[model samples]
Target: MAQITLVAAACVLVLSHSFLPGVKGTTFTIVNKCDYVVWPGILSNAGVPTLPTTGFTLQRGETKTINAPTSWGGRFWGRTHCSQDSAGKFSCLTGDCGSGKLECSGNGAAPPATLAEFTLDGAGGLDFFDVSLVDGYNVPMLVVPNGGTGQNCTYTGCVGDLNDSCPSELKVMNTDGGTGGVACKSACEAFRQPQYCCSGAYGTPDTCKPSSYSEVFKRACPRAYSYAYDDKTSTFTCAKADYTITFCPSPNTSQKSSQGQDTETTAATTSPLDFNSTMVYEGAFEESGASPSILAHVFRSHAIVGIVGITMAVRWIF
Candidate 1:
């Protein structure tokens, strides 16, 4: 009888500690490393309480930390070239939340902006995060898990800027009259076709085939959401831990340069047949000749509107 009572007391203690303040939430440290000012924006999922301030100016090399509940799910992106008018109306040239005010409040970033998306404490006690270009590419973003217990709690994000390589048809210029590429639009967002958006008849992964535009995105950010059905290799899982999201993290010295060449003799090329047909199909997609460049990089470190995934949003309402 005494042992049973002691066990009950221990369980109660555990439960209490789990619900204690400062112990059941995730912390996000957002750092802006761009040359210009980046107006950072935050939007929580519906019914999920928002952070202190949804939008704020993050100067060059500035960093800010925000707290979120344990099971909170939302996204963050950097809005560039922002300003306030004489009447105190706020707006950004890129990654704008369309609030007409400095505070995004509960509004998510418009499409075409690079996104650092997160869903903490999800299935199997794992947190899911991804850099999404499905909406389009804006500023380069990276999600680095801080102390955590898991095998795949590794860094995941679009390491290199994608605006530079953005196809002509998909480039979204800076609203402030900047010359360089501000954001790269997803094919779906750019064209809104059933094939690109993966809607209607193209709902499943098997049906929604990768197009030329999507191929570029898939090859660039292999670990990011390139299309609506790009779920198999894009989603990453991690345990409870703080996250560090860096916008335009200083390009690495050896960041896959776009100049290098991979010359190979193909006079008499012969590929071996894989025992597994699935492996062969996978290899074919990989061998589509989308070489590495800055860890799936492109863009000029800016963004505008974008579409994340038109068909594959479960935990997030936006």
Candidate 2:
């Protein structure tokens, strides 16, 4: 009796060990922390090629998570643009300038070029890490890593102006023989004409007053903002603001998958193992636990017998 019991226990142990799933990969959660919106992309270590599903919208203060295969060994980073629309929503406008046309001059219809690409090293997994969204004006906003975070892009100034152009231009309501037919010729003229003013102060004969619209326009556009990123200085400068893009090293064991979702675990990581060091184990049950151990063994022992039994069972059940 003792021998029989021992044999059965040993069989169960072997079955459990053989049937356990294995860890297949690691995952990462990217957080948006910049002031503007972001469109994230995964890149290789050489930065030569992009990985699958390279594009995703990340509004300011939002987060997203992705999974990578255990076989992948390349670095991962993100590229951001101001024009990325939220999911299920269409972009009112496209290109780097956000919603408005690139240029306000001459029909004003050229898209702006992408401002910059932010890169980060890809590891086996990451927790809720912060990724920033920066605007053309070089403003920094926040985003959480993965879908666990909420959308809360901060608008320090006015919104809905599109174009993302600061010192926003005042809309001219009426061009009734103003200095320029459609737009203002100079700052002085914009204020002098009431029809062009957004305040609607100049349009009516009774209120024909020269408003300060020109001054406001100058305050918004102001010589076209310039951005300077000095690698040597390790700093980014725009207008009157400066920031540093720094990395925070984390322990290898501190990493965790985003939201504990199985689907997301496979998106951010690489595919089909490559470099040895780059590979990571997700767990032990991921690969081996597809069916019951007894069924698997029975099928393995006699393929014909199992096939016949399975066919009969399926027929009867259906």
Candidate 3:
């Protein structure tokens, strides 16, 4: 009887490990290296499941990690100059999702915000990612892959302080007493012309060429998407890997804070990956154990197996 029970238990374990799809997922470690508070916003792509938290506050030097199921697609950004009014409505000067609260729900970031976009388990089973300045620049961001494969799996982001050098017409100035610039607006947002906006006849990538303004952004951030059609050098991909997204990744940022406060010394930037080094894919939930959502699925799977296994074991014993 004891031997039969052990065999049934072993079979259950094997089956669960072999067929559990929910066990596989990706992880994102978000870090804030800025001198002031940063509110990170997340928006899952339409038709996909939303992440655990859509938005949250991160103090200087703080870090938070979240998990995403395989094939999850979304974008992450930072909100600045946020405050709650007397009516308890939350708002931000830049990168606001317009949810009226910390959580962005299903909303995406407003324009003039730096964005880190991702599509996990995408075409050819690769994770496609990029830091885009196409909507314009509000902060310096870096996205680094951890333990992934493929030649294009590497570091990508915009570390330059574009606000300081932003063109006068494209700069979003701080409304507060400080005269410093807060964000840099894209040419499309500034002029709304067919050429810059890539609309009407310029809708196709062939018709839309990099404008002089986009060139400025490209020169500053070679790996980031500067214009709508800038995909060749901007997009990066990796297979079966987790990611770390850092805000204000530069060791030193000359741009002033959105609150117009004198910036303090910020944290040093992280070291880039050594390509020669070996990478091992440590799955998101595997390292930290299953999250609540994953756990729910895990338990449900086990319950089904448990019932069958026990019934078989009892029949064999009888």
Residues 159-276, model 2: lDDT tens digits = 0111222223422222233221111222222243334331355445344432343333223322211212112112112111111211111111112335554421332232211113
lDDT of 3 by residue, 1-318 (tens): 678868777877866764676456787888887777899999999999898899999998888878787789999999988999999999998899999999999999999999999999999999999999989999888788887899999879886667767899999998856677789999999999999988999999999999999998887778999999999999999998888888876533564457764332221122222223222111211233335665466456666777777777677777
How well does candidate 2 match the true structure, expressed as C-alpha RMSD? 23.0
Candidate 3 ranges with C-alpha deviation above 4 Å: 1-22, 255-318
2 versus 3: better lDDT goes to: 3
Candidates ranked by lDDT: 3, 1, 2
Q: What is the lDDT of candidate 2?
A: 0.29
Estimate, for each residue in 91-163, the C-alpha lDDT of model 1 and write its tens digit. Answer: 8767889999988978888887888888889899899888888888778676777777787786677755567
> Candidates' lDDT values, in order?
0.68, 0.29, 0.81
